[model samples]
Target: MLTSTGKLLSMGGKPRNKSLSLPFLMNISNTASKQMTKLRTLQIGNVDVIGSRFNGQELHSALCAEGFDSHHLVWRKMGSDAKTTEIDYPFKTPMNNALKKLESDLSIQSILHPAPFAIALNEHFRAADLVHYHLLHTGWFSLLGLPLLTKNKPSIMTLHDPWSMTGHCSYPRSCDRWMTGCGDCPDLEVIQLMKKDNTHGMWKAKRDVFAKANLEIVVASKWMLEKVQTSPIFSHFKHHLIPFGIDLEKFRPGDSEVARKKLGIYPGNTVICLRATVSPFKGLPYIYEALEKLSTTKPLTILTLEDKQLFKDYLGKHQLIDLGWLEDSNLIAEAYRAADIFLMPSTAEAFGVMAIEAMASGKPTIVFEGTSLPEVTFAPKGAIAVPMGDSDALTESLRRLIENKELRNSIGKEARQLAEAHYNWKTHVSRIIELYEQVMSEKATKANR
Candidate 1:
């Protein structure tokens, strides 16, 4: 585990220099007096990772706490977190809005925005020893400037979805056209929908940028890594398979009685918790269909987190509890604790953070096959997985978990164990930090050569 300079390396992949007390440091020079500088990282994405979407906020805070100078540059700043900075474009809002409309019409993603230039000019970007990109297909970043923006700097992009390799879609569902050049897309109505069939052009643009850029790819699931390997655009880059992590202490098993009481739920009901937002890729229609097939003696209570409330009119006699969008981690954890079952039947999920959170919270979660969920939850072992889009199978899976208390307990226990062993928050952050060191070390070696 020793680095190139023969510095003593620790199990966590950080160099332990006798002269320097700090564990994480960038050796800027190999002269007589090796200047040990603190590593500064700049993370760019559409929104703050600390928000509802993912668990990136944990990494950002962990980086800062570990004495690494970390800054998050998001397009929309949600909270007063000092580590996050909002991107300030030079153009007026109206002009940018117009450009967005034009870009969408022409099916050119991230080409019209000057946000990349803005990011390059930012003080944090200039001072950053490494830059990490996340969720960049949100239409604000400029793909054309990716090579120039990352020039002479070690860069990493976490493939939050399959959008980076494909033409227009994020998941591609069952489509394998991304393996080729991505011409003549079968469905343009997918997420990040295109106005025209300029998918080939957009795919080519990304390929060109990635060809010139020194970028490493990271995926949270093995399923996603397979797609990356098949991608004509991203297959050449180095890939990191790092699963997402959650705070096990906050999301650990709790008394369901207490959780239900706090959430205002009476006894004698089977509670199922799921994400509220309705998307084409989330397989909401199948969820609705499965609910219709289940015939349970106990009353059903559907608890939803996030914005949309889809169960109000759908569940006839069943109860519906929508907590709306939750920003606080405590409340979100409480919602999971109250649930007897957690369902995520996504047709195209890269890596489901909620699935692992529910697993850590000791819930028997169910997911569909043909997506990352099966691999993420360890399939039929850590979670109950049914065939993709098969409502009848989903209903049978639900019935098996509901009618049998011992089965639910066993599955939940195993799920929690899996989450702890594989998805520890500290381990996840340390692995990433190691990646940063690896990338920096390789670059330094190349420069010396």
Candidate 2:
């Protein structure tokens, strides 16, 4: 039998007012479910576990573990040459092959059109007691199918970045483009397109579709939450903040000496690590500049997970170690343990998952102060949050960590404690379930009315 807690709340009695604030709604959800009936949940997203770049894998894993009827949907163009292969990793499974086959049959253009994908998604939505969406703005799945899915169900959308709010998929700086509305885009010329003028029109159409869906917005960081609050496109939707959690058992501190040996770092050499796929937004250039200034004086080894060719091209015979894509959790933990300091100077970040992972591995982190990095690090005593894009501050902070062993150790210990207390997967997943229940209940009540 299909039962909804939200329906019961609506029937139980009328409140003084129907409008409830987030805290009140949360309180009601936490308390309401115990007295009411349970409902089946449906989660929607592009969850390719083998594809390491997307957040969908983590979210789907967490949801399934919490006992939701999580159905992953992948939409790609049929007869297309796009290769949908599991990233080159050791543990390839039958499920990966199946997903690849399914992806092969799906058409990208068909996925981008509302009618067909909507018809397919509606079959699942009809069975679901509640719906959740993990949205990526530029994707065919989100652009075409989301409106159709939301029409029949109570839905919530999680925004991973500021792309949807602006016309551009991502804007690291220069808020002016998004603020005034996106026309005459800097990226457009690269595509050999002339200046276009649908900035306000495009966003309004997108915003209207999203706003009409009776959906709520979820952001991963307070920084993002603040931006959403200020944005004209997103201000109307109900907003919530939920940060990503790390698997502590895998990421926790390991033996530093053992880790150093495995990574081939000398026993006592100070190791500074930055773990990210190479991208301009990641501030690799700043780190390279900082390294050049300190390299001659300090016996330091810089390590990163980047393409070997790209790293070599960037460094140009500079003595640096490249560990391409370490997927093994233990090896990643060991890499963190082996490091004396972790550096992340990203110009734009939604949340610093890597920073928390490094913290769990008992390493002090150096991060840029302005964006979501500060929110993740929380300005821990061991962490040094330098002004964003300031190479000199980064250099100074790097030198300080290199010089002061006691300070590094002290901060690293605090960072580990913080991760254990707040950033564990168990705590995070529990909170998410609570929000899911609340949203579901509220939807049911509205339906009953």
Candidate 3:
């Protein structure tokens, strides 16, 4: 229950629900939520392109559906969303672009990017009753302007990755330097790489910015929330764990026979679908090793999205059907529907939206442990998880699903049930709306006091 001051109260004065369950989010009263319909919301993030950007776009549309005067501001415009406005990055000349590249190469990323300050001057930001930010560190918004952007607003930031807390790199692979001041980085070649080791200085700069910033943090998984709790830069802020949701209706279980016919795949072949990415964090080496170990009498058809030719060498013995960067969500959902099993063995994921999408499509998914995939997918029940980089275990799990039809059916059914109960798009929007209202109410109480 929510108190008059908008603070969440426990049932009968007990502790409140803290888990990423739907029931906790449902605690917000309908009257409070209805009041938020007239609220103006401004969401800022990297433009809607692929990955996490799509999540922001979905939320923007959902808020509009809920009658909020919602607007989106992005660093660039990759999609044709009418409500979204692109930030004005000055000096788009050739020399300026070269200088920007040089700055990024030196690891001074987003410092020269004017998107953060530009957002403060944006009309949408000025009129917004509540402000939400996502994916700000993707070579766009600088942390230096975060304090100014959020100073007098009821602001919330959805931490899509560990990038906000860390000095450099989105994922601190095997490096504990981020916990400390982050000096002397072991690997400068990590994503958002810094050619020079100014990690300590960068870390200190972020810490200073965070000290002056008034923002509530949201994480999609317990693993990510744990990361936030441990970070000296962000440990003081209020935190919420809300799992990412998917379109249950669009990605629901479908007939494999019909889907295969639509995709032109052999109806009798056992199909395994996966998003093919070249990133080392995705654990593609383990996937290749696991596929090599699988000894099947019949050739297994490999279905891939994004890059197609990455698996061209394995095409002779095993069939490869590459969907090649699908822009249409319906087609992507169909790719999931056509497959009997889905593989997303990411080694260092914050959260796996694809795993849940596969689960919603009623396909048994295989993932590796030590990341948020297991928890997000409800491991050993909705999805199968093996030790990280254990190709043997991955191969064994794949073989079990391929050989046993009953096991696949059982797991797929369970995955679908969990996806329906927990990952509904409407439920996700409702949770976010409740948070917006709570933040506004708290701000009001503070002003009254």
Error (Å) of candidate 2 at residue 313 is 6.6
Clash pairs detected, candidate 1: none
Q: Cα miss at 420, model 1 (Å)?
A: 0.6
Q: Give the per-residue lDDT of model 3 (tens digit) for 110-220.
A: 666666667888888999989898887766556778888888988999988897778888899568889998988888887878889988878888888899999998888
Q: Which 10-residue window in model 1 sums to the lowest lDDT?
A: 27-36
TM-score for candidate 3, please give it: 0.92
Which prediction has more favorable TM-score, 1 or 2?
Answer: 1
Q: Where does model 3 exceed 4 Å of error?
A: 1-30, 49-55, 89-99
| Top candidate (TM-score) | 3
Per-model TM-score versus the true fold: 0.90, 0.78, 0.92
Tell me the deviation in Å of residue 353 in model 1: 0.4
For lDDT, the strongest prediction is: 3
Give candidate 1 misplaced runs (Cα > 4 Å).
Answer: 1-37, 49-56, 314-316
Q: Which stretch of 10 consecutive residues in model 3 shows the poorest summed lDDT?
A: 3-12
